[model samples]
Target: MKDLFCLIMAGGSGTRFWPWSRTVKPKQFFKIFNDESLIQSTISRFSTFISTENIYIVSNKSQSAVLEGQTSMLYRENLIYEPVGKNTLPCIGLAAMFAELENPEGIMVVSPSDHHIHNEKLFSETIHAAIIIALENEGIVTIGITPNSPATGYGYIQTAEDITGRNSIKQFKIKQFVENPTKSQQPVTLKREDFIGTAVYLFLKYRYFLNQ
Candidate 1:
């Protein structure tokens, strides 16, 4: 796992969870289940495989105090802070730059800091599968959750006809993304091929090998 790096995005304001999760202390810092906070659990999940040195958390500079108090196990430098919350793409781009500086060929696995995944063993397997796919295909690989309902809140992923299967983990060629469709637009029962966008991504330093 020397070439594997994990980037956890923890900069969300948690405005959706207003009453409990404030700007001062977002939902990521809250201990939603058990003793560990959401962010802590997230870190722990990746720590099972990725070294502590390779796991980095990106959040707003304002949350430094809370982040420090919560995740003291991390290296001081690993806690990357943005001057302001520029949202997901910029946050990820910043971490990608950091990973590239450390190792140009490193495979960066990006995840959210607030997700609650129950099955740790399966989660690790899925991540490793995605990493293998990314390295073998030299492209971006994402984990898509099969949506059980026609939920309009989350974006939907449409996959192409082609499928790549390895070690029981199947990879699909993404056709397009349907962002938060209305009830009229979404089918009452989703097709087996469709999936909800979970934002979990694995890619090799923004395709660094392309330059070679």
Candidate 2:
């Protein structure tokens, strides 16, 4: 994992999970399942595979203390804060930029810092599978979870019907990115429309490496 870096994006105000999840204490720092926070669990899950030095926390200045307190294992230097929220793409771009500086042709595992996984074994295997795909190709490899029910809070990914891959991971060609649907649009049927769902794991292989 020399050129592979795990970039954890944790910079939301938790507006969606309001009241309980306030500005000072966002959902990322909340211990919903157990003693550890969501961000902590997210970092810990990848600790076994990715090195601490290569793991980065892209958060906001407001939640710096919370991030630091919750993630004791991560180094202070690895935390990158933003003055204002410019959304996910920019944050990912920032991490990619840093990764490029160190290693021009590198693979960055960009994921959310707030989410839960039922099976660690499967999750780890999926990530490694995505890593393998990323290292061997130029395209993006995303781990899209099939939603159990209608969810308006999370983003979704829609892939082509002709999914093909040797591994358990079925590689699908992403179609289009759709916006969050309202309550009226419940049970919205998706046909590679990239509907919003429970969660999505994005594995990006920077443009620098695409030429190869």
Candidate 3:
């Protein structure tokens, strides 16, 4: 089996949460849902398939202490810090560089550190299915959530008609990405086609930015 490297992005200041989540201890470090912090839970979710050594955290230098305290179970060297917060792309690129050097042919999984997932089993299954697609193909595989309502905050992905591929996995060719569509743009009723974007994605062999 090829190596699977997990990069947990946790560089956000989390100003949205405000007073409850401060600069030193952001939302990722907060135990809002349960005893374990969000970052810890995120690590635990990946730990089911990926080893602790293969898992890495990409965060701002400011949250060093808090991040260390929360996820001390992982290798100390796995913590890659950004001098300043440059958002998701930079964080992912920086971590991807490290992962590339370690194992250029390895699969890289990029995920946020603060998502609240209710169904762990289903989430894992979806991720595994995405991984299989990535391994067999030469493109980026992202997990999509089926939308129940017309939520403006989330970006909607309109997938192409089913091509009768992957019997178990509901796979499709992405037709287009509509970011935060207005009421006028969204359909009256979301059918079997609508899906919301989840940041969680897998890169086949660390050449994520490249095309076939």
The candidate that wins on lDDT is 1
At residue 172, candidate 2 shows an lDDT of 64
Q: What stretches of model 3 exceed 4 Å from their correct place?
A: 182-192, 208-212
RMSD of each: 2.4, 2.8, 2.5
Candidate 1 Cα misplacement greater than 4 A, ranges = 188-192, 207-212
lDDT tens string, model 2, 59-172?
A: 889887778888779888789887787988778787777777777877888888888889888888888888888787777777777666766666566556646577776566
lDDT of each candidate versus the true structure: 0.79, 0.76, 0.77
Query: Would you give me the overall lDDT of model 2?
Result: 0.76
TM-score ranking, high to low: 1, 2, 3
**Candidate 2, poorest ten consecutive residues by summed lDDT:** 189-198
Q: Model 3: per-residue lDDT, tens digit, 1-212?
A: 33788989888787868989877778999998999999999999999889888898998788999999888899998999998888767787787788777777778888889899988877777788777777887777776776666766556677777643554667777777777778776574255445555444545557654322
TM-score of each: 0.89, 0.88, 0.87
| Whole-model alpha-carbon lDDT for candidate 1 | 0.79
Q: Spell out the clash pairs found in candidate 3.
A: none
* Model 1, span 18-125: residue lDDT tens: 889987789999998889999999999888889989889999878889999998889989999998788767787788787777777788888989988877778778
Clashes per prediction? 0, 1, 0
**Between candidates 1 and 2, which one is better according to TM-score?**
1
